[model samples]
Target: MKQKIRDILAKHGGLPTPVDQLADDADLYAAGLSSFASVQVMLGIEDAFDVEFPDNRKSFQSIDAITKAVSGLVGSTEAAE
Candidate 1:
């Protein structure tokens, strides 16, 4: 899961530093993640994980936040299935 997040960030983070080198708690916005890129990342994550993001902006703050949010959505979706 972390690897997938890293891959998504690597593809869309727009950071000067590589996404794989970033810590999970790193401030992605501070590391140059733009709003548009984050939206793209969110769409990628939703497609990859087969989950829908709720209408919450804070869900994409950092890699850790996104991981937790995705885990929750995946968990609930699996439970429902």
Candidate 2:
């Protein structure tokens, strides 16, 4: 899941720094993730995971946060499966 998120970020993050070079807790915005790019990343994640992020949940600051969010969504989806 972490690698999947990294792949999405690598494609959409628009960060000046390489996604692979970032630590899990690194602040993406600080690394040059623009707001528009973040949205693209969010959409990519949703498409990859087959899950929708809640409008109220605004937590995509770092790789770890995204991993946690995807884990929760995937866990529930798997339970339903």
In candidate 1, residue 51 scores what lDDT?
Answer: 86
Question: RMSD of model 1, in Å?
Answer: 3.3
TM-score of each: 0.87, 0.87
Candidate 2 lDDT tens digits, 1-81: 788899999999988899999999998888998888888998999999898888523558899888888878889644332
Looking at model 2, report the run of 10 residues with the lowest lDDT sum.
Answer: 72-81
Off by over 4 Å in 1: 76-81
Each prediction's RMSD to truth: 3.3, 3.2
Which regions of candidate 2 fall more than 4 Å away from where they truly are? 56-58, 76-81
Instruction: Write candidate 1's Cα lDDT for 52-80 as tens digits.
Output: 89877688878889888988988854433
Instruction: Give the Å shift of residue 58 in candidate 2.
Output: 4.2
Pairs that collide, model 2: none
